[model samples]
Target: MSRRGQRLTHLELLERLVSFDTESSKPNLALMDVVCDYLEGWDVPFVRVPNAAGDKAAVFATIGPMVDGGIVLSGHTDVVPVAGQAWTTDPFALRIADGRAYGRGAVDMKGFCALALAAVPDALAADLRRPIHILLSYDEETTCLGVADTIARFGADLPRPGAVIVGEPTGMEVADAHKSIVTYHTTVHGHEAHSAKPMLGANAVMAAADLVSELNRIADAMIARGDASGRFDPPATTVHVGTIAGGTARNILPKVCTFHWEFRGLPDLDMGEIPALFAAKVAAVTRERLNRYGEFGRIETVEEVAVPGLAPEPGSEAERLALRLAGRNHTISVPYATEAGRFQEAGIPTVVCGPGSIDQAHQPDEYITLAALDSGAGFMRRLIGECGAP
Candidate 1:
């Protein structure tokens, strides 16, 4: 590690990383550059996969020799926005209060990333037989774009890791499966007239309300018929409408209404059915309205993002290796989604284990306990030793 004293302390690294404000809406190039410099200092060869806009990028660094099967240490570089969060201190500045490092990404992530970087020196100094890959991705908070690029590189330009550990905030718990996230933005178009002349104009808000009711019905039905996999909480898919916008004035009929909704699906649940059901409901509702109005009304659903869920594969090498390395006999399921599923879908075996508690993630004044950091560091040390890195 660092001769200065086993690299920087976790809090120190957290402070530096938190100061960068790598929010999902903004570019993370500055933070990526800093990480690149640290890797280069250790003589690690890395490649940059920049986004099409060239504003943000993912950094992939390989330690040990290039090989067919290695371990990929993955973490997202982005943090959620601090907008409207009632923080006691600056959200971008790490504040240690009551034995906690309070900051936007201290618990959600960045802490794990910092710990991985801190362990880099130790990994670099070891004699290694197989490679240890550091996979830092960007835009994970936005749409899971960065990990997708990293996964696409596997077995082609990139050496596919035998196992991938997604370092999300899971309190060092080994998560084998989680729900998938699918977000949709829907718009409804209707003719507008004076509110007093309700008969003369189609009401967009009314149509949106009908659609939302249908969504709720669909969600209830899914819950009643739970998925076969009993791993997930609620044991089924869940749908929620998060945001809605419509009329500008109470006196005027709304011409357009829009809403954002999402669904978290169990691993075995098919997401395609959700939209299809909604579409069928919308078609029926709109057909009735069109027949009444002698005109057509429009309802459009646009997919904002879709993140797949991790399906438990029995006798999978990924799970077997993770259990062996983590010294755990069983795998647990998490409610949150990670890049693990994306990696698994790319034909790469993946597991989820990391520092910090999911309870602290995305909350005001978030923190990762020092004990979590220590445990994660130890995990990395063992991983490097097992990989035969010197």
Candidate 2:
């Protein structure tokens, strides 16, 4: 197809993709359908890796010959929610104006997916010895749960990639490093009693508040110590309490309290240390309360998310390929986590490079410029040329 034809196809496909409200919490099978149909129409061979519940799927497609050295273009199908966000345009409908496309996930991800899908015909038409693979997964906005499963299938049910490029919002730059994230969901248990006899009951909310304070102190200490490589903005592993809820009524002692917290740590940081400290604190509180309430007060914590971050490897195959495609020579690190780390951990050389700006992501009135879309399309063209069919 001509460049003009490709532009139309890209825009049309993006509009279609933006139509699906594939938020992280909802099932993304419908969005996968759009991708499957597009690949089918292009005669591209693809596989759908469905979750156990059959409510979600990850897609892996290949164009050109089934070769050993294949390049993987990866992106997530699920997006962040737009429930309370204020939007001038429909969050699910693509609106074009002033050389930009406005919609949720347009900049955060779907834009890259659309570009990769739109490039299929060109890739198919190119004469290439190596294959170009498209890997799209769900639930990236939540905990990268979808891509984690997809990686599990690689080299077993799926082909092992020589190099993987995660198309996160990078403004078309080669991103080499990012921070790892670990999340915890904590619950405090106590005995309920009348407000007049507070001494008879354990205070779950108070215990939870103390735990949160301890976490904050730990976070402060990390920041003060400062990690050796201060590439991250905060320059330290940070902990934060995201949400908390507990008390039922003002007059009664609450029986349960719960909160979710997260830690974004540098690659070199010992991940076990933070959790260990938290556990010790919980044990101390439990032991102290046991003497008074006799098992009425205790705490439990569950690891919610542990997304490993991408570490930059100087002159790695993934970085070199991304730089060539992006026409850049320098690489940078991001504070956000992506599936690139998971791929790298699996022994596949991986980099995060894609169009659009992270600044536009997860915000109200999110939009991607026409120039960014065109840039991504150009990158795809280069990738296709690099993977010419035999």
lDDT of each: 0.83, 0.86
List of clashing residue pairs for candidate 1: 125-390, 126-389, 126-390, 127-389, 127-390, 128-388, 128-389, 128-390, 129-388
lDDT of 1 by residue, 320-343 (tens): 876776778888899988888899
Using alpha carbons, what is the TM-score of model 1?
0.93
True-structure lDDT of candidate 1: 0.83
lDDT of 2 by residue, 97-176 (tens): 99999998898899999999888878877966788899998878777778777778777777777899999989999999
- Candidates' RMSD to native: 2.4, 2.8
Model 2 poorest 10 in a row by lDDT: 1-10
